[model samples]
Target: MKRIYLLLTTFSLLLLQACNSFFDQMPDDQLTLDLVFQSKQYSEEFLAHAYSYVRDEADRKGGVPFDPLSDDFDVPYSESPAYPLNIGNWNAASGNYNFWQDYYRGIRQATYFILHIDENRELQGMAGGPQLIKQYKAEARFLRAFFYFNLLRQYGPVILIGDEIIESDLDGNDPKMNLPRTPYDACVDYIVSELDLAATDLPLHFTAQSERDYGRATKIACMAVKSRLLLYAASPQFNGNTEYVDVVNPDGTPLFNTQYNATKWERAAKAAKDLIDLDILGLYKVAGDDGNIDPYRSYRDIFLTPWNNEVLFARKSSDLGWPYEKHTAPRPIGGWPSYSITQQLVDAYETASGKRIDEPGTDYVENGFSQADGTYTEAGTYMMYVNREPRFYVTVLYNGSYYPSRVNGDQRMEFFRTGSSGRDGARDYPHTGYIVGKNISPNSDVRNSQFISRPYVLYRYAEVLLSYVEALNESSPGHPDIATYLNAIRERAGLPGVPQSLGQSEMRERIRHERRIELAIENLRWSDTRRWKIADQTDGGEFWGMNTGAGTSLHDPAYYQRTVFERRVFRKEYYLFPIPQSEMDRNSNLVQNPGW
Candidate 1:
């Protein structure tokens, strides 16, 4: 039995050249192209190296990670991307920290792998030679599709470069050299078609009877991508988006269709339903945790358990050391105190019985210190925090909330003015009087250097369930499966089932709200707001935080009040990120995104 890469890829087993400026340029000091594939290790090493291009959601050194980018949270630092983006200071020149070049480089690498893999004499000579080679081809193709989907998700329509290399410059002056942007729908079809071909060669799941190939791409992975891609294409952002009507190719060919396609939603729903039908994945439930479902354990363990059943696709390695906790937790316990939870997101969670506070005939409060339902004991605590959803307790760490940190000698988090981890002690304390609780494991002890590595999930069963519910409601209008899937998530979160009387319009809001709370800090909020065409509404407004501006003292109730920290302004141009000007200068066939 061959040892699989702990990260699901052997890329990290050996360090490779970081730069891919000229992917085709041969290294003068290394193995020759002919000799490289002669050995299985060298060949597998090259293929494994390409896996690093996959996105990392928990990379905080990349500057405040994804959680703070949306209105859900705010970081205290003014130098980070979130701050500049929040204040409307990002421009094409500055904001364009684009991935177009790097992704194309990865695609080129995958193409190279597919083209040269047949030269592997070792693999070709095996008893399973033909089957192994076929799997390799499928892997390369799936990776190529994955790269393209990443580009599509971020930059929208992009040129679909096939598996052939051209002997020409990539600069703007050569019209014959540059590939024009493929139409949005065409790009979607090409990606799906590629996955369809690759899936025939991939397995559903690795059988326990076999000791090899645990983390490789599978039939289910391809289906999930197809579902997510179709979901995006069918969304309001890409489906019949009139904003791109004037945005077309230089030859006057339309890239984004102006007419809405209702069938696309049906296709999305069907695709997601297929993945759900597989039955291998589901909302992760903790067995023997009592009927009162430990929502915290159920939710937190999604990212903690090694290759847990909930994870569909993830980075199965812990490359960084306790970074998630360090970035989100407070200061007294070796935390950065940077990532802070916002009042907006705090208000989104419903009561334990699944009722929104602002809804008619409900007893929930958004403000003031009243101890609404005796969920916990604290003096003059915010009434808004009591009797809220279990997810709210699992997520937000308010001033009075008790949270134990294994890294800090099992010490709990303290967030008031005079508390150990309060604003009075540190200059970089949380901007809002709250911290996020989802990403860190309760057993992780950074203080003792007892580190644990678990897969960082990019796609999970719960997301698929939610996506299916959202699409089903949109397509068939109040479909019953919508309630079935949505209620599954709610029940796991220790909440009652939703009212069956909820119609499509009402269900839509319910679905969105559920996603907002459930998927918070998982890098979905930014895209969700954009795809739902609610960025302008959700993004533009005053951002609130507990008073860091003019609080008199710990005795000041004004210090406990929600104060306006920063006013965020989002523009229409922000709907699509700007293609870096360097790429535009290099490839004239490229057009900048709207208002860039």
Candidate 2:
């Protein structure tokens, strides 16, 4: 635990002002270096520009490709870049979601801010005095380290341009400008150390600051990144990955550590436990008048309720909620309805009693309609949807599901052939019968062009708990703390805990399953599958969905049956993204990912 501070408000204000200020600069009358950094406002605006590079996780269409790239969700249009990406129809030269240049530019901007902000005499005389300078510099460091973490996640080992800034007058042919990628473990170590340094100056929480400062970098956020990054480093994809041994620089310098490191898992477990031991965060819960946990409301409102206890980091100000809801809402209610959830994700939800539907004695009835209302859904709901966990109803928009987004009132959504949201020529519709129901605000009325804005949650306490248990299970199986944390998530979701009798391998599968259900559609599965080296098993080949091609009604046998909607291709090289070929042409020291 470290002392926390608040400085994110300046960032949001800077974002709004950059468009009219820095972005509006012209060559003839552009603000010079001294002119920009001399004034406190301009200096703050420049610092905020570094925050602008944060990923638009809300943009499922392109900004965040992980959601659609995974098996959990589908995008209908072939014209969308993700469509070609899913089918393995593109390459490094195709220029698909190439953020390599964009993120590095962000890193440079942060570095520039850190190097120049002290020139502002006005900032030195501000309310907090010179201590504000240290906080601002730490903030810039967080953003720089954060950008490097993303680059490493997507491109494996990226060129780590440390404190030395590449001078603008430097030639493109200079070896300084065309550096080789750092080794994988070194990259991980550098990122974690940077985050630790940033945390010392950041606040543990933003409660004492203005509400606008809520999303700023905190000690908690730094710890969250450290936890996740170490978990990835410990996983099979990077740890002892023999396939990437040849992924070396031009000088025969290995960019990836080929030897297995068992201690990486121990380091990961310690990082997660460090966060949990703080005891400041808990699973978001809602209790009814009966004083029992209302799992349905608890689960649904985690996204709907802004700034809840479960949230660690979120985007406080964004225009993406409207478009995200518009894409996910029913087509009849002015939505594209193309952001559909796969049947595999639909099947991932457990029964109310915490049993998998395929397991014996789980009592999953595939053919019949519900006889009565269960905990999550209504009477006469399809048997496939009835008796499922509260998270299922909150996450899936099925054929007869009710959507409150209609102008008139709540509408029972239909996805049958004759239904309003169903197939009509080549128009956009869910290839799967279900739409993504997670993170969609219930108050949104897309038909009337109305929506309730909500924060895009980037990290939550549940994930921290799960990460701790996962890493702990890997490092030391049957630890008493494993069941303690794992059951907290399950209990919040209105389910039972795992039996302590289970062995290491059994607990491993259970943890993975819980992650799929708890963190579903949050853009985590793509990396999870890749890091675990299970993407080929889970991401490739025939993807199934309810027959959206046929079906006159909800109960029609032709409509409800599982059908193959798309065939995807996943190769070993797909585990890590290819370094853009343009980058290869410019930097002879760089090596492309294997099989690219």
Candidate 3:
């Protein structure tokens, strides 16, 4: 892969532009790339720069909010970048959340680090010696592979630049600079192989003496990434889909495989099973006084607890401490409360009896108020929110929900027209009459000026388990392990095991529904809906919620009824994000996606 050295003047210009901050500040005598790589400290700094492009999952106000793009939530501000996309204003020219350029810049940084890190001799006499150099190079490899996975999932097939760091003095018209996009399956295989090689050199777990290295790449991180990548490759969007059969390069190279392959599912299942066989991780749990697992605390604390057994990958530092919590807090307690959940997500939660609200014997009531349920709600709580699953109580904040605050003396939230979190000005209310409860710490109080410091999880054991079952069902449906692992997830949530009578089709829908509830607001729903080829059915047309326009009191009938808040457009072309128009203009080898 390193033999093919192809770098264009366009790539050079972008590379120089992206590296100005790292390369320009020093005196001319010390600023050369060779001089920077010769020092051990500077080489470490460059490795850190390679990881600077990882998306902050806790970010809500800055980059694209993925939850709003799916059917799970609505961004109330018209100024949001996702608003144009939701209303059908998206195009190839649309620059909303364009990561194509950012990720390639990261790839170039990591590639340069991998190529030049061996030049530093100071590392040879250090604590870990030349083997430490090998480990550093492997970390760079993992980062490069991670960036390619993000690119492939969003833009489909992309140009794989491999391990070469070419420097050319020729004109910008060189044909080597204009390589065509690699085929999708080939890209998957290359990334998987890179991860496999990286896993060999990375530590399975960092020692307590090296506690500062908690969030760096590890052998398990590599395996976790491979599982997710193969699962996407085996999905309906990329596997045997006739929609992209005509998406070929200018020289007649097919960029997508149109033939269905059941073996891809088998490969995905094996990747997940390989990780599960390690036996080092399990679902994070907390026990009640009676020694039974407390489902509510277990689910709620997964995000708040740092470096727990449940987290396979996490970011140590982020800007989500107070601002993120403040946004989800009720406005009466000094919060913005504009980020709200959708009724579609509210309806997805099963009753405490492990049954859908519409299912028989669910005992679901939607019309009146109820006495305090002793947990999750208080006296006079709305009947619509009563007797729901523990995860629902942990994840959704509704009208009349009890909120605990050290400064506000434990108040109840109100979302009526004249209430605390109701429709006020443009930016202070929830348009859907609900607030996001997941990921916000229970101890955080905006009015008290207190926030919880915690790590943001990137991957966890539960997601890998879910992916394992999903892939196994597709490849070998009714395999006993499918029910065994699926039951593991269900039982942790305090629900009973799934019925063994369910066939493949019934089990498939069941797995998808569980994913929507378990992985909601974790930044996976947008891709999950797209890969399953069901975005048009789930994300199109009118969206409903509690009536935010009416309701002046706590029990207002008008406020309790479901009403349409926004209507969205989801076309077939929206399934694959368009290749940014600027990329096509800059490189002649690049072609626009269909219907962009």
lDDT of each: 0.73, 0.82, 0.81
| Segments in model 1 whose C-alpha atoms lie over 4 Å from true places | 1-29, 61-66, 167-176, 206-214, 287-292, 318-322, 366-380, 448-450, 549-556
Ranking by TM-score, best first?
2, 3, 1
Candidate 3: list runs displaced more than 4 Å: 1-30, 166-170, 206-209, 372-374, 404-409, 448-450
Using alpha carbons, what is the TM-score of model 1?
0.90
Per-residue alpha-carbon lDDT of model 3 for 1-596, expressed as tens digits?
Answer: 12112111112222213223332122222245665577776677667656666766676654654677899988787878888888998788878889998888778878988888888878877888689789889989999999999999888999999987545444466775677789999999999999999989999954321665777889898999999999999999999999998999998888999999999999999999998899888899989898999998899889888888888887666545556777788877787787778999999998888989888777788888886564667667788898788999888889888554565556667888878788855457888888888887767768876777676788988899899999999999989888888888888898888987689999999899988998888888999999999999999899988988788888888899988889999999988889999888867788677778
Cα lDDT tens digits, model 2, 1-596, are: 01000122123323333233332222212456677667776666666667777776877776677888999999887877789989999899999889898798788878877887788888887888477777778888888999999998898999898887776557789989689889989999999999999889888865544675667788888898899999999999989988888878888989888899889999999998998888888889999789999988898889888988888877665544566888877765677777889999999889888999899898677777887777667777778888888899888999888874535367677777777788865466888888888888767778777677666788888898889898889899999998989998999889999987689999999999999999998989999999999999999999998888887876776788899999999988899899999999988788888888
Better of 1 and 3 by lDDT: 3
Per-residue CA lDDT of model 1 for 365-414, tens digit only, reads 65667633364435466676777887888788876665556546545555
**lDDT for model 3, on a 0 to 1 scale?**
0.81
Clashes within 3 Å, all models in order: 1, 5, 0
- For residue 402, model 2's alpha carbon misses the true position, in angstroms, by 1.0
Off by over 4 Å in 2: 1-29, 406-408
Clashes in model 3: which pairs?
none
Q: TM-score for all predictions?
A: 0.90, 0.94, 0.93
* Candidate 2 TM-score, true structure as reference: 0.94
Question: Best TM-score goes to which candidate?
Answer: 2
Can you give the lDDT of residue 539 in candidate 1? 81
